[model samples]
Target: MPREVKKRGRRQEHKERKAKTTDHHQRSTKRLKTDHTADNGNALEVSGDAGDDFIGFDIAQPEGAHELQEETQFHGLLEPQEQEYYANVNNKIVANDFESAEDRATFIEAVHRETEGKELKVASSQSCSRYLEKIIMLSTPEQLRRLFSKFLGNLSYLVQHRFGSHCCEMLFLQAAKHVEKEHNKNASTNDDLASMENLFLQAAEELEPNMGFLLTERFASHIVRVLFLILSGESLDDDIVKAMLASKKKEKLDAPASKESELPENRRAVPKSFRTSLDRLIRSGVSTLDTTYLRALATHPTGNPVLQLLIQLELSASGKIKLSDENSVFHKLLPDPELEEDSESAKFIAGLIYDPTGSHLVETLVKQMPGKQFKKLYKNVLKSRLRSMSKNDTASYVAIRILERLGKDDLAEAKELIVPGLPILVSRRRTGLIKVLIERCAIRGVDLQDVADVIRSEYTKDDIDFLSALLDFKRNGVQDKTQKKGSESEKSAKSAHKTDVHGSLLAQAILQTSDICNLVQDSLLAVDVSTLTAMCQDSASSRVVQTALSPTEFNIQFRRHFVPRFYDQIATLAQDLTGSYVSDALWSATDGLHFMKQRLARDLANNESQLRDSPFGRNVWKNWAMDIYSRRPGEWQALAKGQERDQPQGGPQQNAPTGEKQKSAIELARERHAQKKSHSTNRKRNPATGANAAISTNA
Candidate 1:
């Protein structure tokens, strides 16, 4: 019978092997068809090696199949060991499963065997029993009190040495899952739920350190979801949630290394693990200790989205989440107090402010923090944040936005804050902010003219000198007479007698005439020409007009009275004014000759003829002639002689009267001749007759 059974077994094995080979061939055929379908529509067209036709059969069998089948046939041989292993695992998972010490020992031994000396660090059966007993026997208050204290201690330790905390976390997580299952089975009170939560928290404290290993978003998300469930007393595991929170807190406190470094050595860097963990914990809805969390987050080597979200949450909780409040958060995030003299935080902050979404927040912060302290802080932060921004134009744009917000209301404070760093900004061609700052300075009574000088000295190549001059002209009066005179002297010395090549003087003269009108029309015109040019080119005409018209009261008074009278005087001597030498000389000579000639011509023949011509005509003519002769007696003789010389060249007039008349005429003529001779001698002797004689000299 034994021989027959052995032969039968061999035949059955052969048959099974044949069946297996057939099954492999069928699978191979199906695979071929699938591949053929993928490639084209045809099948059974074999390619490559036919020798490998049986390779599929080798892959189909399970490894050690024969040995496993033999072991299964002798299952009773290891049933006790299997049962013991099962019982041990069950006891760790379920407190009431193990009834005695011997049972527990047997289960542990089986677990040891099954695990092959691998660490079988399972919860003790006794500990499980004790935990169940406490849950059943203790009041809710007692359980919570014990759980809280235990959790705090465990959490502290976990935070200190997080890498070794994973094993503890896993054990606690299992316990939490078990508790959750139990709670679901029996509906419990809120207080009982709280007690259960405390227990989970205690486990979480032990598990916190392991959280640092979670790198994936999904893992962090899972942890966070679990935490939220715990907080709300939902079906999710609490221990896992607590572990995530504790881990996140530890992460926030950890110092991170800067991203820019050359050396690569094994040293602790700010673990990305911590950030992921925190993100997960937050998503889980874990309650944070606000002040502490914020402080810790603020100290991060780099910014974190999670921390930013946390701040938003806290601010929102405090009812500070308006548009303005949102802006404040952005500003706060900006690097301030200059952590590094030149840091990237400033640039990052600048970029944030530049974002369309963030502009409102920036505006809000400026508005809310309108105090000197805030201004100083903000200025420092802004400077540092923009320090490393290669796109200074963008930075400048952000700064402009900040200034615009600040200038609209708190201009003085804004000016004070920005003026000190104007040089640095100007060097970068950050005109947007510079312009806003300049406007603010004007509003704040700052003399921006000097600002140009300051910036020029500091940022030599920057084209801000013109702006400075503009500001200066606006604040102080445009013209300093003393300075102008000095400048004129210097200019004159430089040019000597050379005519102005550019007609600049003529242009200035024309401009001067119209400049007053322009000034009266627009006060801004009172500024330097360069400023006016800038305004004309870059600013709106309406704005210039508005600025000009701002001093309406003063302009009205000046135009009405002072201007007209001043112009009338100018008109009176338009041709014979100080600028004309010929007119001046002619005017002086005419007046002097009148005085000298009137005195000598007082008794001439024409004077008598005018007295004898007619009573009225003679009297009138005699008075005019006598009046002229009275002023200049010497000029009358010279005039009479000139007339005699010009008369026809004849011997004498034969219409002579008596000796007395002729003697009188002769006496008059001789007297005229004697006076003329003397006057002629005086003229010849007078050095003033020479071309070299100074016109100013009186001979």
Candidate 2:
């Protein structure tokens, strides 16, 4: 059995590291001139000798790690009075208690006046830096320009400062939008101000020489990550990328908005120069560090994320020059196009497979490497290890990444390896690999029945048992039973919670495949009302229920049986945080069931006060359109019936009358109206040709 890697929150570990090293300053390294790219071409397949006996570099330190020496810069501390005033300002910003927009602007302006010329001091001060973040968070484009100009030359030093890094991160994030705006020549553009693009490019240049060093530095790594993202026109909203930039525990400053602005989902348009700068940044990383130090970065806690992003940006570059260039980061990491199993590069790949930090780099490599490299690696390495890799906690994520890139035939082979392990994977709550496999099968149009059959066999075709097993319902009960005392019990509870989440996610993923979702749908329909209601009230399982009722997933028959399970419990569900979402899903699920829609709506109406009292319930009420149902029920019913009606099949002829079918009163009235309008138009157009308007109208 592979040792389970203990996964804890890296954020707290990072904080402890910062506390230890914040006083230290890193010394610049003499750049190595050794070429890492090898031009060796050999037989494409791995040798049989490349098994467990081979030793790669030391897992602890691949190279001699450099220690950062403390370098002090004098930024005078804030006076007691100044500290108090800024603290007050921070409090106000946090509370956001301004009477009006103008008042808030005036207050911010006053604070800005006092903090002018002391930006560095304020940003570096632990007590006052949060205020600096808040200011940047709410700064106008012009104000941002002024602050950017002030911080331009000091970015090299400021980026590594513990408190100062937070300020810099926030500034870059806020200023990034302005750069996008300027690129599009929006209203935020100002001719008199320094261009955000130029300011950003200038900042990049200031840090360009240190870019390689920063990639491995604890604090500076995050700033460089954000800078590259902005320069490359990547969205900052990505969760993985965002997590790297800031801790979840970091205080959030909610800036008041005059109007909500949608961040671009796709890459924003960037200036031609920005792309050039991005290329230069990539080149700095590729050329600055030798292969050993770069490989060492694969496991460096602070550096691995930056390396992943660097790898991503390098491969994603449009010129495709890097893919062919032997000197590129891509080539340096894996010098052999065809990885021989016993080669150093192959060993390095193998070493990273189960190491927690290093495996992430493997994931990035699998995701972004060109098809040739991917196929070569897959053939040489990953193809043989899919089963064991999928079962290991650390390696399973890497497995997921590989599964995502496989073709249809490749996926079928992978299914062979992974499907047999589903029983073990479900037991371990390693459902991510399972989820990706099923999703890939769906996408690749491979038959899902193999995996579905495995599931059915494992859970023995009993719907509730299948669901309860997949949903990990027993774990929660076990957790409740176990949570009586010690640290061991707490650990059990946490583990159980993780199992619940993974199980719920797997269940939801299954529900998306209509053919294979039968087990889940049947289970949901057959489960008692109390059990169904309880599932909806819980957070993780609620998502499974919502996905089952999604418009595209299950049909009306499934929904008709499933939705009314909540008929007597609509009020109970609407009042819950998690259940409220299920209640909202009920509206979509009731499509084509007019009477059911009204009945559910009426239940919601009866509980109006209960819903109004709870925030979650109010959303359900609004989403259900209970107000319209109450005030104008006739119109509501018509709208509801129309919504529920099936789209006409074939054409108008299907709904058209057969022989002797009489039109309804409303239809006959509509015909008369059409005839009168036609007569009036004809009489008006041909009045001079002896057409009689009055006679035609009467007829």
Query: After TM-score superposition, what is the CA distance of residue 195 in candidate 2 from its true location, in Å?
Result: 2.3
RMSD of candidate 1 to true structure, Å: 42.0
Q: What TM-score does model 2 achieve against the real structure?
A: 0.76
State the TM-score for model 1. Answer: 0.22
Model 2 lDDT, residue 258, Cα = 43
Provide the overall lDDT of each model, using Cα atoms, as 2-decimal numbers. 0.35, 0.75
On the 0 to 100 scale, the lDDT of residue 410 in model 1 is: 52
Candidates in order, TM-scores: namely: 0.22, 0.76
Candidate 2: C-alpha lDDT: 0.75
Encode model 1's per-residue lDDT on 1-699: one tens digit a residue: 455445456888999899999887776545355664667664443222233311111112222222111111210122455446545554463554557656654554444345332221211122222222222121123333333343343342322222323323332333343344334445334443443444555434333333322211212323322332333332232342234333454322111112321122322122233334433444232222222232333323211222333443334333333223423333235424343325554444444555543433443344444355345535566544433331344445555555554534455544545567666654544445554555555444545555444544653244433323222222121222213334756444323322221222212221223222332233332335433332222222213322332223334433333222212221111121121121111111222233322332332233455334434433333323333344554543444333333222111222123352333436666777999999988874534556557664643
